[model samples]
Target chain A: MTDWDGRRWHDMGGQAAGPVPMESHDFALWEKRVDALMVLCGQKGLFTVDGLRRALEDMGEEAFETYSYYERWIAAVNQNLIEAGVYATEELAARMAEIAARGPTYGEAQDG
Target chain B: MPHDHPDHDHDHHDHDHDHDHGPFHHEGMSPSGHPYRHDNDSPLTYWQRMEIAVRELLIDKGRITAAEIANQIEAMDARSPTNGAAVVARAWTDPAFKARLLHDASAASREMGFDIGPLNLIAVENTADTHNLIVCTLCSCYPRNLLGLPPDWYKTRAYRTRAVREPRAVLREFGLDLPANTTVRVHDSTADMRYLVLPARPAGTDTLTERELAALVTRDSMIGTGLPLRP
Candidate 1:
């Protein structure tokens, strides 16, 4: 309690949020890919797990609140890649635009 | 408005501030001489799409392979609470093992064959007078190497915020009502370290096999947010 900043999102606990649910959850395809990509890149020395955590922490409050848990991981991965010069931000935008034009053909009907 | 969309989109206007072009001049963050578009016919964000683009680029660059990424994903998917379950069951059955686990969770887990990755994992024990809980307030810093990914709510703003402010209340909401004198200690997982709770063995289970006992240990119990099932 000497010099701790309790205002941040990660340090928050024990405040109050009603009864927690015990529901079972399954990961989506993109989420699973994000987790694996983060680990693979980490093993490749692209960045550390701590680096991703710090990147997630540095996000603006708006983005921080908006993205889900796995979505945040993807964002962190993207940030690291862009920072590492793996691709230019312009390059990413163009790729995204191209994909969007091609339409949402994401999941390959694995389960859904 | 983008707000009306479920994805909480902000559109190309947000990036408009950084570039000099007003209507359609371009050269902001993307540097393509054109303003960014929200014509994303899908539910993906700029970041999510970036995830795909970057991953594909990495694969194409020979830095990583699609098969490698797929294998990693498969390995992660194969992990569940069962790894934690077996560890807790062994600790419950053997005093020496329990001590070993409490002394060094990562090594003990490795002894059982589940690679604990590079992070430090400390196993907190729950006794008659004290209980333990783990949370990553800044992000969902969980014991992924041992427990796979965490639950959605565990990373929610509500749980993250409240779990620190009122641990007992949050636990009670999860139906864990500790005694007034019981000391509830919450472990906030940071970047370099993670935690798993070695919940006390339930009563009347001495006759169960290690496998059966292991089956009783749910993901939430190891996280200290739920108690093991009584078998």
Candidate 2:
């Protein structure tokens, strides 16, 4: 075994792993919204990208496997925003519950 | 903050302008030549619900606007490998600009009219005896302002970990095998600092125009996982 580097699970440098997966897909509308939100929120000083990274890293390795890329990202974004006091967890919970009741499709759920 | 006033919002109901719904949406390919991913009518997901909630909350609080979000999406969509390719092609043809790029990549890219904001970028050059590869082991940090969103593999755990440990093996898996004498250098991208590999110009391409040369540069080439296309 190699000497320990004290790396976190998300700090994956120089570790053993499988072959790189080459398949890729273009960003969808919702994914792009997540990306835009991250960028704009950072620009507005609501939170830094570092803060988002911290939230993602803290979510642990299991979340990495279970969550898709932007899923993890939106979670991190929301975490950071809540930490930044941009919105309260209560507000997010209420909003999500409201959203969940809207419809079964993304478009139908767009409006309140 | 420039246009954060609530009065500027066109209408809350008009957010669907970005989506093309229904049966005819799959008629043609996106600019990347791949079919568009099915969105909108797909079964609503947990994460999708969170996105809708967060976006609506942000808009409701006047922290952001729907128009701004739409504009931001359009701006990001405009950025792609093509932007980096143009920068690489220019560096190959213009010695002064290449020096500027190697010195201060962010400024050099700004000189070309790419609104990169405050990205601190570095340009690593690939030579006959030296090769460069980029990875973000800590997170999926990338030079997105210039190269658009990173490829999905770039954010994978396998590539992130293996690229730093066994670069030659990673390169080979990417269908790139450096000669025995060539030294391989791997750069780990960070939150504040991003690297763009200046892939070496393919040989026998002296007669090609800048635009033609740009076409030969691929996304993987800029990331140093693959080389520019041969003429």
Off by over 4 Å in 1: A1-24, A108-112, B1-47
Model 1, B59: alpha-carbon shift in Å?
0.5
**Candidate 1, residues B1-231: lDDT per residue as tens digits?**
101224323353543222111122222332112333332223545555656677777877788887787778667756778888999999999889999999999999999999888879999999988899998876678988888777667867667777878888888888888889999988988868899999989999989999999989988899998899998
Native contact fraction of candidate 2? 0.76
lDDT of model 2 at position A7:
74
Predicted structure 1, TM vs. truth? 0.81
- For the predicted complex of model 2, DockQ is 0.51
- lDDT for each residue of candidate 2 in A20-89, tens digit (9 for 90 to 100): 8776776667888899999999989999988898898899988888778888899999999898888999
TM-score of 2: 0.91
Screening candidate 2 with a backbone cut-off below 3 angstroms (N, C-alpha, C), the clashing residue pairs are none
* Predictions in order: chain A TM-score: 0.79, 0.92
The candidate that wins on TM-score is: 2
State every prediction's TM-score relative to the real structure.
0.81, 0.91
